[model samples]
Target: MILTRFKKGDLFVAVVTATLLLAAGAAALIARAGAGDPVAIVIVDGAAVDIINLRDARAEERVYASALGTCAVAFEPGRVRIAAADCPDQVCVHTGWISRPGQSAVCVPGRVAVVVRGDRAEVDAIVG
Candidate 1:
């Protein structure tokens, strides 16, 4: 019987290729799972002004000059928009919907920012 052997360099290359493929698969899975989710809320001066939901929406409404401090963010279904803000720039008002994890919209003058956070649970310690 004859046996075929793999050289050290060949084995190393094979291992590296496997590792790269695994990493690519993991990245794809993460991207697919992270699509369209609400990640965070931005607050201004101790009040919540914006709520960012990472999903596309049909329509967005803006409400300004309200008693509740002049800035607010709202989300409906797969859509997010700045509902209100005291800032004159009104840039956040036009930010519109963000339909992916890690997406964000901000209003500088209002001191409000919204960002997405991952859903993975923290692993505090490992037990042997």
Candidate 2:
């Protein structure tokens, strides 16, 4: 069998590697869980039009008019999504709901972007 080709030391190394990967994944999940509530930021034409805290947001839809067309954003208690858009490509709507921090849905043709951000001050990007 293929498994017989590996030595005892190889099996030990594989087990250790798997254990470390699991531990790292668990740590990442724990950190995200404790990072505080997440908020969704709606940007139109490179300007923030709305910032809704997902924890306290109501179930509703907000529509905005953009340069290319209009778009609708739906907000739930702990998630947000782009429901509809008039752009040619419906990529944003296809993205579905996003409840985690750092998730985003963008309508390039409509010039609209919805980004989810956590309360924790994590460096989103470095521009140099």
Candidate 3:
């Protein structure tokens, strides 16, 4: 075995660092739990048309018709999806489902976007 030595303050620094890391993790989990629920905001043609609470929503589909095309949006508890759309690409439909805050599905051809928003204000990005 090889002999090694540690400075007196080394163990204290390590313990303090570990404690801070654990505290940060616990704070994050508490914040997420305190965030009541998430909601989906529907925007069409550059305007917000609807806001649906995913937590309280039941299984259902809502159809929206705009000058560009028609799109069908489906909602279930804690999630939402683009069930169908007249857009040629079908990208939105293929997106399947989104359940998390800040998630979104867009149908470019139809000019429709569904964005999920959390009850708590989240810092998505910070620009310098």
Candidate 4:
């Protein structure tokens, strides 16, 4: 039977298949971790209101119901965005997806700001 033959070609094929499987698994984990594994910190009027992990958040779309205003949020593999917002300007919604640490979406009218937190330095640095 072919199963009983331990040929060089067959051994190569088996090793390649196992390596590919491992690579795929690692990719999935990295996608879920996001770059730098930032945390989503919701700040209201300079106060931290909530904190959520961006990596684990992509399991499903969510809405950050705000008594101040309405903003629907969604999480994809390594990014998050305000899918919709009730703000008059729609600026927050238009801000689109944010994945990296220090990126943020602020809804001025809603008095809510979502910022990604991480260990990266110079998050607040201003450069030309």
Cα lDDT for residue 122, model 4? 43
Per-residue C-alpha lDDT of model 2 across residues 2-94, encoded as one tens digit per residue: 687989999999999999999999998887775578889999988999998898999999998887779999999999999999999899999
Whole-model lDDT values for every prediction: 0.59, 0.90, 0.87, 0.75
What is the TM-score of candidate 3? 0.68
Candidate number that wins on lDDT, 3 or 4: 3
* lDDT of each residue in 1-128, candidate 3, tens digit only: 22266666878888999999999999988877846588889999989999988989899999988779899999999899999999999999999899877788999999999988886747452244
Model 3 stretches astray by more than 4 angstroms: 1-35, 125-128
Q: Write the residue-wise lDDT of candidate 4 on 30-110 in tens digits.
A: 775544567787776667866777767755566665558877777767677778888899888889988787688889888
Candidate 1's displacement at residue 77, Å, is 2.2
Model 4 stretches with alpha carbons more than 4 Å out = 1-36, 121-128
Best model number under lDDT: 2
Off by over 4 Å in 1: 1-37, 45-69, 120-128
Ranking by TM-score: 3, 2, 4, 1
The predicted structure with the larger TM-score, 2 or 4, is 2
**Candidate 1 local lDDT, 3-87, one digit each (tens):** 2666788889889999999999999888768543544555655576545443443354544333334656666665455766777
